[model samples]
Target: MEFRFTVLASGSTGNATVVQSGDKTVLVDAGHSLKKLEELMGSQGIAGHDIDAVLITHEHSDHIKGLNALARKYELPVYANEATWAALERHATHVPPERRVVMGTGEEVRFGSMAVRSYPISHDAAEPVGYTFTEDGYKLSLATDLGYVSDLVRRSIIDSDVLVLESNHDPEMLRMGRYPWNIKRRILSDVGHLSNEAAGEALCELMTDRTRRVYLAHLSLNHNMMDLARLTVNGVLEDRGHFFRKDEHPLRDTHPYEPTPWDQIKRKAL
Candidate 1:
């Protein structure tokens, strides 16, 4: 039983992830157009229709843009919580009747060859939640768009082979940057995005023996650099007695949600 994941895109621009077990594949988000997504999957030697389902994290444009269109093109099922569905229903069109499965926080939803659990998050929305996927004995946890990682969210991320966690910005950079005071304040709020330091600190607290790979994600293209995100996570990891050289960290797919092998680490997923 082999488990893999991939990222279609990361950062504030767009976000998507593909997780698969053997022949079954699931897309965590579709932030790109169907054409772009199909091209990306092709680059990885996967067909667009190979995706079994689409799981949305929130209604943010960056995460939801390609969802409706992708579903239209591929006729794929979409699994999202009730509130998330309500917010997105205005955009739903072309999705088949059996394709919408409304879920809730802390509930489990099963697809072929894998079991998934959704848990509430602190993002400013109606019951936004992160996802945890398990197949065989390996676990992959996906959490982004979180303002602050709560105890419940923290506990759900434990014992994983791969973690696609968010490190949205650097406090110093965001604070000193030219963004307006209101936007900055909103970002710093509990229901806002996560800062590099905050994300690192949260991971430090939630990590365990089973947590091996960590992929920093949902970065702010405006205020943060890849090196900055990597450095922050590495710094926190080292402080918590879990250090890895920059060259030694696990990488994600070219897009978000792309999987790296559980045992190998790289700058980007292959």
Candidate 2:
């Protein structure tokens, strides 16, 4: 069976996606309320009952905000690395034992016909990770909430068919943004967030002729303009003789993901 993926939602407001392959379906994260997910799925002619699992990247409220409620309602399994699991355990009380699976960093996990791998990222969180999902010959990678992309992260997502990458800010924008000094410092730290220039730099390492699409993700509503992020990444990628396969919505099936899947990504593979 052929696999398909769609960004149900993104941005700092909320995040989630729907991935399906025949009888198998997965929700990478569910920051949006169950009602929202239901609405998103319905818009795409999907049903919430079709989802089989939910994989979380970190314990941040933006990523886990609606997780417990969804888990309780659907009895869906949720996967995360040890440290992330521990961090979430403090708050994910509604999750039943059967629905909480502690994933091993850098190891491939099976969700029916799909294979998901979590790799460590540069984030301050306990064990944040970027995700790569493969089925048949297609691969989808999600990289967000990271400070930067290192050699390890580059390798984890390099050959992906579709990559949802974080373009969190523009250096100049962040420097001039209204965020307080301390918050600005945190976003610029090694474990903070990826700037547009940084995101562009990272893409240089991961782009390939095989890369069918690239989704710029986790855009800072306050610090970035879509045109700026798009142009920055495209220019950098162009320098590498690469460009986003933009014949479609950037990440929608007919296009795939959206303005950032709001999850915290840190490298575990490296």
lDDT values, one for every candidate: 0.76, 0.76
Model 2, C-alpha of 23: deviation from truth (Å): 1.3
Listed in order, each prediction's TM-score against the native is 0.88, 0.87
For model 2, residues 63-144, the per-residue Cα lDDT tens digits are 7878887888877888888788888878754578888888888989888888889999998888888888887767889888
lDDT of 1 at 127: 66
Q: Which RMSD values do the candidates have, in order? A: 3.8, 5.5
Model 2 is weakest, by summed lDDT over 10 consecutive residues, at 252-261
Question: Which candidate has the highest TM-score of all?
Answer: 1
Q: Per-residue lDDT for 47-152 in model 1, tens only?
A: 8788888888877777787877788778888988888887776655335657888777788987777898888888877668899988776788888888898878
